[model samples]
Target: MMLPLILLYLIGYETRVTTACSRLEACNSEFRTGLEVAGIQEPESSAPYCAELRAYSQCIKKANKACRGDLSFHTSTAVIDSLMKRFKCAQQNWGPPYKRPSVKPKSNSICSHQSNSEYVHCGIFGDPHLKTFTKSYQTCGAKGAWPLIDNKFLAIQVTNMPVINSSSATATTKVTIIIRRVPGCAEEKTFEATSDAPLRPFFVDSSYSTGPEGSVQMKASINKTEKVEIYLRYIDTTLVVRRVGEYLGFSCRLPWDIAKIREENALELCQTGCPGTELLDIASSRGHRLSWETALNKCKQDMDLETGVRNNLTDQYLDWCVFDVMTTGKNEFVSTAHLAQEDVLYMDPSSLRNRTFPLDLNGIPKPSSAAISNVTLNLQVTAVVDRCGRNVVHAPAYEGAPQVGRVAIKVPPIWENRIPVL
Candidate 1:
């Protein structure tokens, strides 16, 4: 999938941040608890954001220093103030105020009074510059440069959470979470989704509720990375609260080379190493040039170290050499009995005429035999892009090194009885 241009911004961020975990104990606790609330572990042991946070924090620190260190503090605070102005408090009145009967009580303001049943806290965080945070004037419609967020880990808590579905046996509240200090546009980007449904407009209390319910306090710190932490709370009884959570760990950027390494590892694990020496040599020689070669070689190397796995590399350049000889009977120097086997063997008259034959009882007869004059070996090779897929070459022409004449035989004529079959 084509991820948004935000990926580019993350690449830059990765270099600047160093230590994302300002407090080891606190970060670990948050991670453990968050995982418990999430119910499942993060993918590939990447849960809790401890590792990513550390890296992001260090990167941000570096970037901050380069941007003038303490010089930018006042500016950042100004930016934060501007951004926070968007969120306005909604009004609410729990009950009538207690009063001594001495003096007349004053009426409550609209910010404090509300009838029951209406969602009292419904309010919008407004900013004319909100959308501009993620975009630049140069790139219209394209998500512009992503700004660096303060690496602070802020603890967020939502308690007395609102009930989105008082009727349903199980219902989730949804809240729209906009990343604070995000640059350019506020084009909504979701973290990880539980199912196929997009999680955004994210929920604060429930997965669907719009407002912050109850007192949910999440511990956050400065210089920490941003990861999606979803806390699910349930009540076995009203007094006892239980939580399960699922979190998505986001790296400032995608680990492209790391992914390639994983693929290589998996391939080696699956195939028990590659098929041939030629392929191994080619991979070793050219691995630096292509991701495919590097990945294949790394996998082969790992598989070689693993027990019960043998290197039989065949999909590499060396395999091309091995298979070429096996198919054409041109390179008689290679041992074929153990490497390449076929139900049948075909030979071209020209090849059979001049080639030195291996003196096996099962191999082709010597060139001096009477039958050699009428003998013709029909060899064919097919090109295919994938295993289990149709052959790409119906009747491919065989090309040898310049010193050797290339051979191309038309399909029907090569197979016909009139072509002087061997």
Candidate 2:
């Protein structure tokens, strides 16, 4: 009887082990299928690919759990570690698409090429050496002809720009410039400073209606290192307004260096605790309102201290750190009331565009314009970190790229009498 019982027990144990092994193999097969569906035939660093790989990792984890009691079944730690490394690689390569800043017209004048030609070449009036052509113009000598001439023209030249103060934290610089026009072209000249510069108005040629009436004046200021762009405006001979350059500016490296330092600092903070944690705690105890930007900066500083490097933090790593901090603590908040109010007032088609007589749940006619006032109520506001970190709000869909993560934060409302109904 004892011999028979041992044989039965051994047989049962073997069957169980075989089943567990089969399940593990099935999990691996499913993971491979997921990779194929995700187009991850070869290891490539991309957010979508990494996300798919993570799904495979999850499958492996589930299989490991399912086979927990089986002595012969186990998840491969080496494979998991490899997948994690690949995920990190993918994240490091992902970010929002780059976009160029739009140019805002400084004057009321509108400028266009004089002819319908494919190419228009423009030259400064005074300087024989200065000439530039538009890239979008038709081919030269096609129909409109080359060397498009304007009676009135404006030119911008950067004489000297130097980085006076340079630091890893910030850089200060000065720009000196000059504007000149063709002799007897326009009756006046107006010089417009770049966005970052101090606005100084210097007008020349009072006779020209298209240009600002006055003379050229040079203005300089200490500023965060940035590109120095100057714009020139004047009226052409036909009394048509024309602008010569869009962001015709000088570039430097100081600003970029400072940005790199800040990024590195932010990454270090995410990896480790922010410096002076006790001080931060005390401040929180005293009801200090910590701004999101400030908190982000603090994290950057901590990162810089740890790595002693600049610009080593990628956008993905920073985003992950932000999400982690936001979800783990009450460091942020979103005003649920404001969002709800906005949805009712702006998003609802009936409320915003088409008005209809609708009855409220209380059997009262709903007002054309909804109002919420003079009522003290306890409302729950969600934490901003939680919303952004966990992706509760889906990111806008992109056509060709992975869905990028985003954080939408609402500003706290201040008390004001008679808030306008949106």
Candidate 3:
């Protein structure tokens, strides 16, 4: 009874809440009065209510009057609407609530490439030598870690860049300078001002030229994050090319590899927790009514047959092959029946168009026709377990890789369930 009433209240009451001020004539008159109260020229009657309200809020804020919620009956609808409109507008802009200031490049200074740049032109280590080729600016660099010299600021001209890091017959004017470690070269220490002269073209991050003899510190240097500190310079008017000390290296591990480790760990934990619970479950299900060993063989036959049936979904024989690593017991019943349902979603229907699963009956107990039946158990079990794990976390999926006609499947080690289900 209470549930029905609660549902009725929830569905019916909230939709009917009316605005505090809904009288249209009163609203219009208040709108006119609000302009006078705000000391603003009257807007055309066609102006939106929100616009009028916005102007009112601006007027009140400028006049330093209390805004909303502090009102007695004297709070006119026009005034209230004005405050409400401004509040709604400010909400979208993330203001009044305050927003983080956006970092911008200096007006006078220009950075060629802004992709790697964070806030300022030199904020993050960026190659400032972005240049125009065929009338557009694009990132330019070598295959390895090397600074790209901006052709626009070059004093000399070169036809084409080459592999060698040294200058050749196609070389331009050479600008050489000495290199030395500043006394306190910690990651956090800022570089000292270069000279008292004006700067022309900016330099790349982590590289700088030394100031004249008595200067306190080196001129310009970029921290690891690539922030630029501009200062006075001296005879440094000439462009001096200094080597950037070291290159930072980065590497990544595939998520599938990580999943494998996690899965292996989970398996170990499960083994410890259950202590042979798998065999126990099999034994309890197929009791003394049938020899435990015979039941196990029957289970294995079922699994193998199921696996073959699933193999029809894919032409790859290797994909259907059940590996020992995926199973704890040899010759034990394998269930892949559950996998058939998942195949509707996972397996490509196209793979089955021209594929067949060969049945071999040599020393095996089941006949050729019965072999498919034998494979069924393993397939069902594998499919069920695979689907359950798939539900836990969706795999990092990739679509057709080699081409549209082909697909590649990569599941995490944990997702593999150490069980095969293709």
Candidate 4:
């Protein structure tokens, strides 16, 4: 669970040291935000970022006087002491003339925007199907935490959990996105979302964005579960991370130039899509006894009702809805499918209907609603068999794209069972 944000310091004039220390906790958080402002996402290697460390040390040292009383005071000091020691801040000069190190921008920088950026789209949804920025598509049993997007300006990660207790099949349950500080635009931001505690519109710092970058202001909040959108003004990007069923889903619209195939992003899931894995066709999974007619009709109806944009944005989502319904025996996926389509439309208003994606359906499926009946769901766990003859291994994942892995990882692709679930 995330700590409740404490931005306001409510220290009273009472003489009780405990009260002062309690308030000092707020100062501690405020002091740490300096790191965020410095564009340091990972605090583990914050040693070289000596400026922030010194600020924090000074704050703690000042608190040493009034914040003395209980074990909390001692404990807090111990933690801060350990952090400073670990970073070896004592050896470094926090004095004048001590220049701070530079943080190299990530390989995929966001300073450039091309004309085709409006049509560049990528997403991750049910069954962990991924659509890369290049319009490539693949369904992966990537059953652990994986980076959907990692660039100099932004990073998105998803954690997949088993759908059923004993099944190897998994879905995303958590999503975390990091927005690094832009030189003159937005400050660094962090956001977290889980199935139970979906994301809100604001960042962990309780701020939407650092005063809007020019005429276009950055957007930080959107509805949860249904569809969550965050507009990054600095990068000119829109990120959609949502919750569906027992998991989470992510989507993004980037400028084509920013999505160029680079050495570092060759293996990014959102950049290169998932590797070829013969996924168990959920629609044909045995024992599931699922009825796709209802979902097909539902998603199709929603798409048909939309008059604003005459695009086939719902094509992939329609397929995803049917697949999720067949896999989980639930029809809510129909709404999620509709939501994804609408989100894509809102995220990018370009003529996407004319744009071609690798996994685009020729047209929306036409399902007859004449015989709408209650879908029968039989959630029987089935064996997972790799449809392909290839041996399964814990394939390493990349940060920028799923092709070239730069981040160290221990996640293993454990879904050896290509078994279908009801």
Candidate 5:
């Protein structure tokens, strides 16, 4: 579903200013309680509410720094001022109301990752950039609902929405991850998050830490008002879900041993990237377009972690930062790039250093442009920009990299991290 730009802006304000918003709500509750004590249920003439109205305005003004990132909070004092004008506190009385819009987190979930040395990183964030298990990166629109990972261990799905009005590009807005039931490992628990909604820190059943103590059980919540991390320690996998502005961003780290390719799970977005129809023209587009120069300058200036991030990553992040700002037309969106890299450093340190393929790495042919245009190309990460600075990506057409097909074929026995499912 396409969200209006105005709504997106409002939602964005609520995100960064969550703590201030919380304090404001608490103040509102206190004021309402005061009114109740004075027997003024709903002040008819605004006389009883005038004092509290002024107080509310003060509260808004005081929280200006705390909610500086939230444009909504900036207008709140103005809203009260207009309300007082209409109420005519000088003639009678005026004040803030009892109820208003709120999105408060009751119990937030935190992510704790059990680090694995040999792991393949697959991350999707900021207008939905895709980095596959094999280290191939592609920025495509995986719109609608698609399984990020569908296998015996887990089933993860993400929903993508158009980034802005008049743009075909999309960013993830919601994520629903199901850690399938395994007797020794963890219970079948689900963790879901959306851009505008409060996060569900615990499982659907409300029980915490279902897995055996010190065993492969579901761990605790990891992060904050903008990010949530769930650690499937049993499988040695870490899932990173974040809210960047009005859109959701997601990434995962899977152990190389468990990063298996089976017929049933071949079509997962983590493996196959987005379908061809969801392909976006990041290079050339009139709507929501930015010149390479403009986009580059914005990233260099706004991406605070540019130097540190450069050591760990390729120009991929700058590209994402540039794309995100252009697609959303909001400079704040550049932070998503910083957040994604920070997520990687925390989630998969090896990925930041270099590629993590443990097998015959040299034998495996990496997919790239011009070769797989005719063949069904799956993943495309790095692109060779031409003279016009057009970002062009092509799949690696090689025998080593398998194709997506319905043929049910036998597979070679790979190492398995088995926890007996009793």
Candidate 6:
């Protein structure tokens, strides 16, 4: 985001002022020494130099106030206070009349190295000089002093082959390719079950489409000697593919799963039913019964940790099946839940007007002895689920020390029966 030219200038000016203030004593040592010598025997409150001191202090305060009020500048109150103190001391020591020193203006120029032979001076918005500079550049370029030309190239890269199957008699592969107009545009294309000769060489033509101006078309064709099936599936498809780079190269072969579910069928399954409820029904039909609440809770918990659950069951299944135990591969009762006892801490009058507290290393607040008398800290034992949720286990409650002044309380984690069963 570009800032207004006026704002940029103000920012630069404020920075220079701050830099000057940092070395104020060295910058005006003679004036500061005069103030010190004149106020040696006088108390600051009734000193003869008090008037001059007040004037300097007020000047700094006003400047700092203006800096703070300006949205374009980020002023520090601490720095301003320090500057006021120093200025006041200088003024107090220099009794009698006072004259504020004039501040010099800094240069405001924006330049860049455009080429080996010439440097470019740019003009910002709201500056009349910018218009003149722009016209000058145009006129100069028209005379070929700085000519602009299109020297960019179009590059194509094959990203992925989600589906690659090769049998003794037939070969099939699905490929996703990315076309990039160097320094300009990009597009993705996917081909499904398109290549029958997976190993055959192919030619990609970069200048195939000219109907649409500035659009680069990539045309891939297999060798004439090879028999191939090329079917374009564009960008939208059921299979999930991540766009990678402008250039990548890799090849691999593995046993193809003939029984693998089709993308359309997998999508349909997710769209037709509720995730946990459908899974529970499937488990019950297979001789394993489970409560709807238990299954639903487990599914919700897992979904919360992963991406949010989708409305359609087919999408939910496709998204969660690989990570969830109930729907992935072979479903089984992998774990059990148990009830456990643990102590929990509670704070009284949960809301407090003051939040700042003197906290110890453990983050427990230390209140005064008198305040502690009225503060309440209690430990209550509660039932929680064990890791596996199979048996009951008694454990001490976990509670941190009480915080003083702070009304906010930190709630400890409560154990849950996370083991999903059927």
Q: Which of 1 and 6 is ahead in lDDT?
A: 6
Model 2: per-residue lDDT, tens digit, 53-110? Answer: 4554555566676767653333233444455573575445434422222222234433
Q: Score every model by TM-score.
A: 0.14, 0.18, 0.14, 0.50, 0.55, 0.16
The candidate with the higher TM-score, 3 or 6, is 6
- The candidates, ranked best first by lDDT, are 5, 4, 2, 3, 6, 1
- Model 5 stretches astray by more than 4 angstroms: 1-117, 214-225, 289-292, 302-314, 347-422
Q: Write the per-residue lDDT of candidate 4 for residues 239-262, one digit (tens) a residue.
A: 767665556678777665565534
Q: Which prediction has more favorable TM-score, 1 or 6?
A: 6
Error of 2 at 388 (Å): 25
Clash totals, every prediction: 78, 16, 43, 22, 14, 16
Taken over the whole model, the C-alpha lDDT of each candidate is 0.21, 0.25, 0.23, 0.49, 0.55, 0.22
How good is model 3 by TM-score?
A: 0.14
The better-scoring model by TM-score among 2 and 3 is 2
Estimate the lDDT of model 5. Answer: 0.55
**Candidate 6 local lDDT, 215-257, one digit each (tens):** 3222332221111122111110111111111111111111112
Off by over 4 Å in 3: 1-201, 204-225, 228-388, 391-422
Q: Highest lDDT among the candidates is held by which one?
A: 5
lDDT of 3 by residue, 1-422 (tens): 11111211111111111123223223334444544444444222223433555543444343333324422112333335444543464343322321122223233332111121111000001111111110111111222222222111111111112212321101111121222233322111122212122222344344333343322123322321111222211111112121111111100111111112222223221011111221111111111233334333344342244223222222222112121101222221122211221121121222222222221111123213243233321111111123444422211112211112322233333323433332
What TM-score does model 2 achieve against the real structure? 0.18
Best-matching candidate per TM-score: 5
Specify the poorest-scoring 10-residue window by lDDT in model 1.
Answer: 120-129
lDDT of 1 by residue, 1-422 (tens): 11111121221211111123223223223333433444433322222223333332333344453443332232333322332222210122212222112221124422122221101000100000010111100001111112111111111111111111221111111222232221221122222223113333233323321112321212221112122332211100000011112111111111112111222223210011111220111111211122333333333331222221222322211233232222222221021111111000010011112111111112222332222122212111222222433222222122211112333333332223322111
**Model 3 weakest 10-residue run by lDDT:** 117-126
